[model samples]
Target chain A: MKQQQQAFALPPGAPSIDAMIAAENRRARKRLWTALAFMAPAIGFVAIFLLLPVFFNLYASLTQWAKFSGLNQFAGLANYQRLASNPKFYDATWNTLIWVGVSFVLPATIGLSLAMLVRGVKGEETFKSIFFLPRMFSATAVGVVWYYVYANEGIINSGLRAVGLGDLANRWLYESHLATPAMIVTHIWQQVGLMMVLLLIGLNALPSEPMEAAKVDGASRSQIFRHIVLPLLMPTLIMVTTVSVLAGFTSFDLVWVMGRDFPNRSTLTLSVNQYWESFRAGYWAYGSAIAVVLGVIAMSISWSLGALQHRLDKR
Target chain B: MQKKLSKLLAAVALGVTFTTAAASADPVTVFHDKPFYQSGWDGLTATAKKDGIDLNFSAYATDQFQAYIQSSLMSGDAPQAFTWWNGTKLKEIVDSGQLAPLDDLWAKKIASGEYDASSAAPFTVDGHIYGMPTGLNRWVVLYNKALFEKAGIAKAPATWEELIAAADKLKAAGTTPFNATIQDGWRGFVWFQELLLRTNPEAYAALNQGKLKYTDEPVQNVFKIWTDFYQKGYFTDATSQEEPLDFARGKAGMYLFGDWVIGLVEKGGVKAGTDFGAFIMPNVDPSLPNAVIVEGAPIVITKAGMENPDVVKFTDWYMSENAMNSWATDPGLYAGNLKAKTPNPIIAELAKIAADGKYTSVTRYWEASPSEIVLPAVEEFNRFMTNPSEEQAQKAMANIEAIASQYWASKQ
Candidate 1:
């Protein structure tokens, strides 16, 4: 490398390769600084609003900070111990797991099915818009609408009674065992639209020639879907799955608005329980611990999924 | 020219000094969680203005106000006065040394015949009264007179047996007997408080103080009665959000709530004393004293807030009977001031019943217990409401006792 640099050296009183390299390095550093200067506002915003709060929240979880009592009194590991001992926390975890598990299956399967059904069909835009309408409303509004549908005198029970199945009519949201499932159904109803749109985009982006060639080669429709389309749609599926998982972990508004007084807080997810504990019950430190646990679970799963996507892309 | 310039500079300096002085004359900010009483607060604000103290009022949703105020207090910045619940709820903040004792104000008001000593008892903590009553609400059974008439009931039930019979009659007449709900998570405790106090007031008080276990026989008996009501189909749907609306529509025979429900009922197009009438729930055991649960929200001033002279002036004027009249009459609220007149006849009648019976007033169950316990216990109470059976009641009681025991144990 040194011999090559000497061979490329400039004449005397002119710049040498080393001098030129130094000047180039200086310009590169200046360009880097310019880029950083452009990005500084966004970095500062994330540091201040997101990163700082997360770090402070981590610190707060170790302290005993009730709303008014014992502010910032450090009781190391005590909050986590309390969280471990709490049966409600465990119930919340189990409910959250059900939500996360549902996020994986329902959105992908239903979304992909609808996407395929509507793609290249007559009035496809109309059907897609109809399916996507619920996504346009806020979660709270959707909850309010569905609250009436699940209410005792709501459409479901009313329809049941009209069909001479009055005995089958039940209080859907009131039953403890049914509450989580009912809420999950509502979540899936709202989430499938986004998943469908993303998957539809991916389907449209695929090369039609490969699918046509597969069909010509005596491949069945299912075989073509499995071998040709599914592999290409993997990236969009992973993206949709990641979003659904995060949504499942962080769902609060629907459950809060719909499950007014869920039996024993049975409908409470970790997010709802955290708000209930911190804001409602004044257990700030313990709630922060629950939040930290939720964050860790969500972050680790998301990281693993992202790594999987990266490896698949490399292949 | 120099003389004219000097005069202009002096005038500017005087104007700046006056502006600074005006800015330093701070308005006393009073916070309350009652959005329904915004007009009443505005009336009080007007009255405070006439007293030369500017009053700025802020209202928050009930659920968020505690968190907002507590954090504000801990940060050494809070409004001059804010409404808070009584009993252990008040005691918790007082224990944190965030409140200023209002013993002097209480004594002054009592001496001036504007307030009663008993009205100050709920706000008393460790022998120092930390707040003044915002209002006194007595819980009573507000019955639909039309429903009662249709059910062949001549008047309000004066005994527990009669109450049950009325409920049965109402149910047979194809109307929901009571407008009961578990909505908002707090209403579940209403019947629990009502029945427990009627059955055994001492046990009710003891349970709230952590001296009586929630699984005790007295509480269990109350649960059994509640379960029986559910089995008999005497209650509207537990998850119903329309407690006041149901009663207003005459679909329910009775609604047990604070006298404050009068405004909601009237707003629902039902006249107070014409369409509906209220009566104190008779004691199940005549051997026990006549008791009523009273919910009192108090306005607590922080230590720093008390140091401000404008806040002091506003608070003093607030304790006057004139202020109470302005604050309560327009809203049909029950004023804590002894001399204040109730504009709503139903409240007046209910007040007369309590006064005539010389009823022993117990603090409400929601505010009587520690919030840490009460908030979760209400959820259990709600669970019991959803599935009201002997087994469910027992389970609910056990769960509630576990929560209460944990809270009390932590205190120890």
Candidate 2:
């Protein structure tokens, strides 16, 4: 009775099931090869330009090498050991933490608030464009302009004095305590535009149904934002946070330019410190160690955030 | 099929063009950091052309030059020759074993009485000459003559007391006494160097050589004097624009700068000897002999570059009297060659001072100290200038000592 059933399923003049399976497998194989061929160039580019350099940098971190000199000797963990003992390393790390905190909080808060306030407002595009204008200038140019603005007699001080607040006008770049904060203000000015744009896109893309339903249910605006809008924007918020964290860890150009003229490099972040150690001080091995530490920190943060994002997405 | 064929043909054509270009004569590439000297370099290129050697000259902004040279060297693609600062900065490159000892070339020049062995002292490492001197500059206090006259100063100050008196006169006259620019991080060390040299020249040299500690009494005295100057408001505001500008416009009475500022002064329509005059920074202690800071940019050849005959030939020609003379004529530079005549009157006066044995010539602190020490120490000095506290000075010294110790120990 089973054999009769199988024969009925096959029908007259039909190929065997095994033959059908083999034909499907052949098609899949062909599809895979074509896909791989299409992806080869991109994969090769990432491997050569990104992955290979990262591995090379890791290798360099293990050696006592100076630029323009042969990498002749292996130093094991000596560079990392020095990094652990160096006060400058600690200072740089501390500064990096402050940078990350400020970068995340200031930009995200301002960006989200602006996005909410500007929604459905008159001249919305113009207001957005005005805020986004700073993003068009290169970081170096922004740094140079801000450097003069913070000068002892720069616009900030001059304006304060003009408003009869002369006592408040202080040397902005000269004081170690004020330098980093002053620099952070400049960075926030430059970065707020990006954060606002990203969040604005996320806000616009959100489904209107949930928000409208919450409104009909007599939910307050803040309550609705916290319950519905915030939860839905989690993925984008996570992405924005990761980018801000990365930028904090790698902040160099603006700080370098603003602080280059100042003798006290207390304003140096990890990236700037690495460049100084490797290029200026010729401590390439030590610099590579700093770089490796920074890379690991950045990756760890990204990984943790990505996992959180995945769990949220599943929910 | 036609598109694929055309792509293949295009690739082949591109490969052939690259091969043909590479097959042409290999030029001797030279790197420099002097963007202001295009005409001067043009003259040198003319000399290189006469020798049948194509010269590819590249110039970087001063701040970027060191890193550019370093990366090029590490990549094993360095130019044939490049301009570098003398003293410890040159030693850093020499220690990397990337330089070719120019002993043979230097010996020939010394024998011809064109080059002085003493002048090559800064470029020597392990008893082998690693570089040829390009230009020499002396650090001096350039005072605006008209400004000084208006302030009732009959002549240049000859002592620290006189200098203070002059400053008071200038301040009363509503002009800044001294125009110092820390806009360039390296320039922050100028006052520190000048003060240290005035206090104790020997200790200053030892400090630069990493033998004397920054906490030493001589160094402390330097800080004390510098702090006093800051307190008295003898210096222009810390935020003032770069030197020679303030001095040229008569907004500032004096500027302590290298001879290179003379060109800028000339450009600002101020005559060197007439409108402005150079004077040695007076010794703080009358018991000490006069001292001056001297610096020279050196041109160094790479080891691989020496293997190329054209590079070797070009280097030799570049250091010759004819080439240096051409450079001196255009840029008004004082050649490192002892025999090269100085047509610039102010440079002639400086040359005379340098030739005299009474005044000791010390290497500028920026180039004399190891980069590890200088990089941090200058920052500390910059801070100290603004804050002007003993505690800050002590902290700065300690920081410098810590870096210097680590660097020197690792070297050993």
Candidate 3:
């Protein structure tokens, strides 16, 4: 009697299995169409604003187009060849490499240490906000303010004089050897705040169970952080490094504002070199070549990092 | 069927309305770089209104203006006319074949004796004028008379040796002998150009045209004297503040710059020709002809712009003394029109100097040289200023020559 009742319930008001499967498939297809409809605007925006310009730039790099002049002539690989032989190109590339290396090391160390210190401290929000304050300022404003701080009679020199180190008060931006480091210091000051906030959010999202278990099983704080917290934060760290490296490659405003007045233009990066060549020097094709080189470097680094992240994700 | 017919009628009505609106509102646009010329533009607008033509004037900051003009011209949407530099800089724009020849206007002006052939030379390329010269700026040394007196100098320096002596006296009197600023980067080439022009005017002209090498003797002499001045402390710190401010505060005895800096000096509370005065820089070699570097802004019309009769009318009105008088009086602009009355005394004085015919007028280096050559050369000059050693000077000259050679080779 129970089996008869179960069979009747199972079969009651039910169509054939094929019909039900077809109805579910139709619904799934409708859902997919709706999702695509919603995503159309974003897809269009990326294609128009991002992909089109990149393709156009690639085409421009292959031509001898000056600003305001029509691209009537095509000189395949000529601009890139010129860039390869140009000394300024080499100088800018080396400077960008330094910027990438320092941008990662300094910001990552400062941010990670600050995040760990402020994780559970009293007045945590206040401390976090203070560290995050500089990120709120636009890079241009930061550059202008730091320009004053690095001027010959600016804060740095005045402070040195006040402290009886007057002989050490040299023109910071004027010296080529010191100029890049000076600009890097300003870049780090502006970037550390953002890195800190990102790291803090990453730390908060970390699981408490593993850390607590490690602590309970006779593990030291450093042991738990090394064994559990850092491993968990690896993805965030990689993302932060990738972003910082790209920022280093494309840095312009601070370098332009601070180093424009300097005699040698000693602080010029690849981005600045591109601008000077294109707009100021009116070598649009050569500038495009520099741009393509910069883009290639950025993409290669980002792609390798992404692949690394994917490999780590699989583990 | 009724709804469809009504919709077709509505579409037709809207299209007709838009077409009529577009035809009635075609205004002539003029693009310029100087925001400080608001009063001058206001005067122009009033004249343009009376001609039954609607005028739309747009101004951008210097850098942005250049970029805007470039993009607009490239896109075939350039304005009726725009402000631009004369000489090789204008030649660059003319090379694009976007500019309209103003030979008709030039002939009219020349026949009327309003513009001398020499005045129109800078705007002319290949025997055709592509632009109208509206204003001129003469480069000279503006000095603080009080400081010169305090230093016990009897007269303005007339030779390189005398200038050095005056600089020594000014230094001994505890004043900066010359106010030079490398802060602007372009100023790095100012004194260098002046020295070269004074030493050998022919070589200077040839060098700007890429016909002569930068390592030539005249160029090397300019650097040698510049380095000597630096070593002797005859100039202010290379990294000092702006020249005008320092000169106005009585901190420096002499400043070499364009006549435009007189406005800045006056704004800084120093009276022209009393507390300060100017002189054409003395010739370094007495054997060479005296020359003054003349820079001017030209009004260029585009090919598309020439199609509008109103543009030609406006160009005629702009080149006339009546229109230029307002520019000269309001902004103290020195009109290139010979018939225009000068309002500023210093301008009148410089005009008199220009008219004397003793000193040859040459286009200023910044305007005369190609951008590809001048931009990097200025940077190299800045490097030389920061550390003026013989080795550095050689390297700077070589760098400039290398760039010049590349550009000239490409042209060939």
Model number with the top DockQ? 1
Per-chain TM-score of candidate 1, chain B: 0.93
Tens digit of per-residue lDDT, candidate 1, span B1-412: 9999999999999999999999989788888888888778888888777867788888897768878877877786777689988888888788777789999999999998876677787788899988877778899999998888988999899888899899999998999988988876788899999899989888988998889998899999999889988999988888877678778888688999988878877777999888888888999987888888898888889888788887787778888887888887564676677688776888777666655658888899888888888888898888888888899899999999988898889889
Model 1: which docking level applies?
Answer: medium
Q: List the residue pairs that clash in candidate 3.
A: none
> What is the Cα-based lDDT of residue A114 in candidate 1?
98
Candidate 1 local lDDT, A1-315, one digit each (tens)? 689767776566987777788999999999999999999999999999999999989999999996674456789999999999999999999999999999978898899999999999999999899899889999999998898899899999999999999998988998877889999899999999988998999999999999999888999999999999999999989999988988887888998988757777888899999988888888888989999999999899899989999998998
Query: What fraction of native interface contacts does model 2 preserve?
Result: 0.76
- 1 or 3, greater by TM-score: 1
Rank all candidate structures by their TM-score, best first, as comma-separated numbers.
1, 3, 2
Give the whole-model CA lDDT for all candidates, comma-separated.
0.86, 0.82, 0.83
For every candidate, give the share of true A-B contacts it also has.
0.69, 0.76, 0.65
Taking all chains together, each candidate's TM-score versus the true structure is 0.94, 0.88, 0.89
CAPRI accuracy category, model 3: medium
Q: Pick the candidate with the highest TM-score.
A: 1
The per-model DockQ list reads 0.66, 0.49, 0.55
What digit string (tens of lDDT, one per residue) describes model 3 on residues B1-412? Answer: 9999999999999999999987876677778887666767776677667756566678886766887788787888887799999878888889888999999988999899887767777787888888886567889888889889999998888887788788999999998898887876678889888888887888888998889998888788888888888888877767765568878988789999988777767778877877787888888677877788888778899988888887877788888887777666553566677898875677778887777677778899988888778888999998888888888999999989988998888889
